[model samples]
Target: MTSPAIPFVASSSYPVRAGNRVRPLIDGEPAFRRICQAIEMARESVQVTVTFMWAAFEMPDGRGSTLDVLDRAAARGVDVRLVFWRPDAETERHRRNAFWGSAAHVGLLEARRSAVKIRWDRAHPGFCQHQKSWLIDAGADGETAFVGGINLNPHSMVAPGHHGEGHNHDVYVELAGPSTVDVHHNFVQRWNEASERLAPDGRWGAGSETDLPFPTRIPAPCGGATVQVQRTIHAGRYCDGTAAPGGHAFDVARGERSVFDQYRAAIDAARRSIYIENQYLDVPDIVDCLHRALERGVDVVLLMPAEPDVTLPVSPERRAVLDSRARLGAFANFMLAGLAGLGADRRRKPVYVHDKLMLIDDAWATVGSCNLHRYSLFGNGEMNVSFAEPDTVRALRCELLHEHLGRDTAGLDDRAALELFRRIAKENRTKRDAEDPAWQGLAFELDAATHVG
Candidate 1:
């Protein structure tokens, strides 16, 4: 029995549009391969913005570093601009020596001097410029834009437990069409903003025609898809309103309504189902919204990392979040158990939810740096692209739910066979001393000394 082919919808009907000819590329490995291929094929320009970039990171082919690929594009006369979160100069040596011991900052610096235009986004004090995206002109024929959670760093690419492995999971979308133009416009906006702050003049940076080898205006080919860009930031004046901050600085709070607010609305508006995948699943407001959705008969599912990367001594604040989430999960299970026999209930047996992502109605999706937590919603600077293609939405929904049910370890479902799993999860939380053979030994244990306040 073959599954029905997923449908694709237009952007105008949805807040974000989806392309008709897009295909799903599973896992970071294949995704990176596509990006490398696109970069190699680029004829005019390539613009990359990420939270972090390591000079030694390589593709699966082991051919070159991400920086090396950019340099090659530049040597071939392709305009290559790289922007990343600028670490504080005061703390730079400490981070380089401790966290990134093997980093080649000097090599990257020399590469910039030759062909690449590298800029650091020195935005807020504790906040970071946490957007990960790439825009490349794939020859004079067309352009491609990638937006999602993957960073251009070694940890992001390497498998877990390797020398520089980051136990993280992420997604990126490769888009072509009129949407590519919009993505390019976003890159130019950030580039100018970042450049201005770096300049001695304390204003946005300006680029000249001779800055690179490729023509500045890469003409758009006919008959491609359309794309939309959305972002979030903190509200404040830079340098006490005295000097502009370098690298993609913007008044995030003032630019639009809070990203959290948008997420709340989407969760509330969900008619059929909501699916999420993330690193942290600890946001209270989002949990409240999900509770409400469950009450109204909307199905919710989430996929989260079995283990958090922050394995250091747990802070009181972090513990409070864990406790809150555990309690929330318990409440969700209790509610679903009571409502198990209600209505037609084609909505799956149990209410399922996880951390990595959120899909609504199989019509809308969001993938990016923001987690389902307060820091990502209101504290840290984060960016995510909300997608509205029917096919994309449905496919993501299936992948996540599939993982949840144990039918596929690679995918998880929010509602399918959730009650049994919830009971198991509850047992794990309650019985710390009891070791089960099936347990992966990766579940988090919240300490009792932490206070919510």
Candidate 2:
């Protein structure tokens, strides 16, 4: 049967878009693998905006590093542009390396001498330019884009069906059709502004001499799904604190919170269940809405990391992870569960859940960089692609559950599937405490609000 139309709404926050082909790329291996492939297939341009990237990190299959891949693409005449977060003084020490285009970083780019150019943008000092996105040949018939929270860090390089330290579970949506125009719009806005901040210190070389043009017309439709390109952007980041001229309704000067608006509205409209997999659950508004949904008999299931990523022995950063965990533990309505995997010593090891995802009633879904945390929902520059396609949402839910629980929902309805997860998670928690010999898989429910971070 054909699924009902999603009734996607556009307002001051989210603008409605249609005819987008959205595919959920689960785990780092598939997400990065597909992203690299799309970059390779680009005929005109490749634009990437990410929070942080490691200089030494390499793609799976020994492809050197992300820069190496971009260099290869640039050598073939593709205009490769990189926009990386220029971490504030306080945050700089925590990033994998100094921001891109630094003295040392520029030397690497100069050595390649490819068509690649880069710029570093400073966020709200307290927040970050946290969106992870890629746009390929926007405004063209075959244009495509990707959006999600997967960073270019080593912890996010793990393959699907594999487990270890630095193993992070994440998702990125591969997008085609009219929605790619919106992605293109966003890139042009950031790139033009970031270019202004670039110094004449020979960092950008000749590649930064010209600015990419704003998408004049929306791309032709590519598929059947309805989509809304949403974001959380702090005020004054774009458009000189004014509403964008045309084809976009967002005014970052007013502090657009489309992602938060969408989540609350979707929860309010949910009739059966809401499934979420996020790194943090510290937002009070979201927690309150979930409590109300639970009162209306809505089933809520959330997946988070069993142990804080910051708490890892070799992890250089701890304050952010530890701080976020403390706030998440305050949610009264959330029965948070930490995922676990088996250690080499035959003991249960904590599996980190880093994906930001949400599904409602098997009819609506979202996957992207915005976490259910204050910084992400309010202050950070973030982006997410939401769809009202029932088939895609249900399939994504099943895929996530199968990966984590080692079993499928087996044709259960949304509510029943959520209940099954509750039952299995409770059983897993009991087994974990008893030190049972059987494989514990991933889900382990918490008995109290106390956090494991």
Candidate 3:
């Protein structure tokens, strides 16, 4: 663990909020289950910022579908509002993964008479509105929020143990405290300026969609954690003259890049170890930061997808990762790894690690939708909350390690635990190569030098 004196990285868009409670909910089944229960119990409002949502996705245990949950909340006089991404020509290639308000979707909403208010937002050309969050009972005494990288697709909605075919491994953090005020503020900003708000068939539950007010007061302290909400907003995205709770008012015309800034700062301040699980680890600046950390004797583990969606041949993603490998593979203390699972056809399969989570020195950690890629770090809309709570951070690291290594690492220090992770991952890779199905866990080490290729 880091010294107790080490503080959380500062943020330009939000202030560090103390006395907040944060819980790490691993995997989609656990995350969505809690989010659904919160929606069902919501009495004031259910607000969601969706980036990618498959139309056929549903809540576990027959709770309901995404729209069904919103409809049920609305049917009970609870306000339900959703801001969904609407891809433009540049982002049209992502439309298949997003529930953009197309003619078919508009017709479905009209036919279902969905009472949920909806707004569509278009990102800057070639960028995306990639935030995935759920804020329940906004501004109420019991307000809570869910933030992470989980998407609404069957491939991402699997159980925590990962049965059947390989599924997307992801994480979501549930938060309730003064920090949640920032989430409420972000939703209001996006909802008020959603593109196509005035277009025909642009909004569902028309005549009912109303602009939201910024939260005037912070929620009371709920726990001991100190939290700071961070974001990546493209320049000129939101011009609202509002500020996050306890934060100075920025024009926001210049945008906010606090997520990227925090990541760099955390890696630079590492005293013992840095554990990060992200979809892609191809950001040049981040790779450089990790290189510096490893040079300073800080053990680092970067867990990414065995089969990254970003690394399509001849794609820009491919070039970026190859560049990262060339720079970071020189450090012996740095281990690059990926996860795999048993497929339904009784074959080894790569499970996409869609988690955007990082733990530094077992004292600071962050969880949200911001990837370590240019799109998420600079252009796309993103959200993450960093917390300085030793117990919470250490517990989350242990939980994730157990899931990946199938062993309890709670007794080990952060550095020792990650060293064990490297050994086990390499062992698992050997077993996989031998076509053995008896590997301890889903993790396996990847050759940083040629993994991208």
Clashes of 2: 0
Q: Count the backbone clashes (under 3 Å) in each candidate.
A: 36, 0, 0
**Candidate order (TM-score):** 3, 2, 1
> Which lDDT value does model 3 have at 296?
85
Candidate 2: misplaced stretches above 4 Å? 1-14, 201-203, 240-249, 309-335
Off by over 4 Å in 1: 1-25, 89-104, 111-113, 138-141, 158-166, 195-227, 236-253, 311-324, 331-356, 400-453
The per-residue C-alpha lDDT of model 1 at residue 209 equals 20
Candidate 3 lDDT over 80-103, as tens digits, reads: 899999999977888998889888
Question: How accurate locally, in lDDT, is each candidate?
Answer: 0.50, 0.75, 0.86
User: How good is model 1 by TM-score?
Assistant: 0.69
Q: For each candidate, what TM-score against the reference?
A: 0.69, 0.89, 0.96
- Among residues 3 or more apart in sequence or in different chains, the pairs in candidate 2 whose N, CA or C atoms overlap within 3 Å are none
Model 1: lowest-lDDT 10 consecutive positions: 334-343
